[model samples]
Target: MTRRTLHAIRHVGFEDLGSFETPLRTAGYQIEYIDAAERDLGQLEPLAADLLVILGGPIGVYDHDSYPLVADELQLLRARLAADRPTLGICLGAQLMAAALGARVYPGPAKEIGWSTLDLAPSAKSQPLAALRDVAVLHWHGDTFDLPQGCTLLASTPLCRHQAFARGPNLLGLQFHPEVRGDRFEHWLLGHASELATSGLNPVTLRHDAKRYARTLEQAGTVMLNDWLAKLKH
Candidate 1:
């Protein structure tokens, strides 16, 4: 059997594949991380990989003027998504996907930065996100996007209505972080410590919640990713 290639566009070192890595490997995927800061996204062929995943980052989609790389990523995503190739986007990645699809990406009503379960849309039961029906996932972003035209809304929360969406069997976008690892929860807290402080959120509370829900989320997130990969239109 030939192994499939999975290219993950990573904006940061720590925000990586997490629980999704094991299932991808078990599914016979050869994973490669494209560090957005060091690599040239425009130079790479967007439709070359069997699967392309855009990981989360702190930057906003509207920051294209400030960060030229945002333009490169947008171009890459636009080309890949136009082909309807297997693609997944999380958080900032999701926002970028929406923008590429002609939707507006901007700040949400509030910054959702904690553990919470999604309110699955009726259409989600028949979708890959059904694995996260009642599972608590990590929410660490402040940006949100309008649902792209013709995409099915999967799951949402009170703070954000467009938490997740799917254009087809090959495309999925998640505003929350289902790929976050509980064991490495501290890295998140430490990485975004300043943001937490600005939001008046206490790390002690998040630490306690991570202890309570991280394991459960990890298990559920793995299930979700595996289920999605199985149903991918490859």
Candidate 2:
């Protein structure tokens, strides 16, 4: 049997593979990363992988002018989805996926920059996301995506209606960061302190509850990852 290859695309230097890395390693998959911030997307192709995991970043999907690689990466994501390959997109990655699928990506009403609960849709109760119903996921996004046509809405929160969506059996777009862990959350808070303050969220409160949230967040990531990986056999 061949080992599954998982390509993890990183958008920023601080954002490393967190909890998701462990699970994929345990599942016996070969994991590789392409840093979109420093490297060219054309050089780091994702088409060869059995699974493609696009990690979250602080940039918006439409900021392609400032971050030119955003457009190229989104193009690669579109090709991967078109080929019916398994793809998992988180936060900004989700927005990119939505845009690639012809959906609009724009600023959300308010920035959801802390731990929030996601209300699972009826369709989410069946498969990959059933375990996340009514669960609190670690959210830190300022943008949201419109659900692409033919996609099933999986989850939502009071702030963002399109918290999660699925197109076909292979592609998933999650608005929250399920891969975040203890140190990663703290690091993110510190790295984006100015953005947090501008958005009217206190970094102090986020730091205070970081540990408690990390434990729950890890459990949630496990559930989601397990369910997602199970679909690979089909």
Q: Per-residue CA lDDT of candidate 1, range 35-121, in tens?
A: 999999999899999999999998999999988999999999999999999999999989999999999998998899999899999
TM-scores of the candidates in the order shown: 0.98, 0.94
Tens digits of per-residue lDDT for model 2 on 64-177? 899888888888978887777888888888888899888999999988878767788988887577766555668888898889988999999888999889987788888887
After TM-score superposition, what is the CA distance of residue 119 in candidate 2 from its true location, in Å? 0.6
User: Candidate 2, which segments miss by more than 4 Å at Cα?
Assistant: none
Weakest lDDT window of 10 consecutive positions for candidate 2: 127-136
Computed on alpha carbons, the lDDT of every model, listed in order, comes to: 0.92, 0.82
What local lDDT score does residue 163 receive in model 2, on the 0 to 100 scale? 87
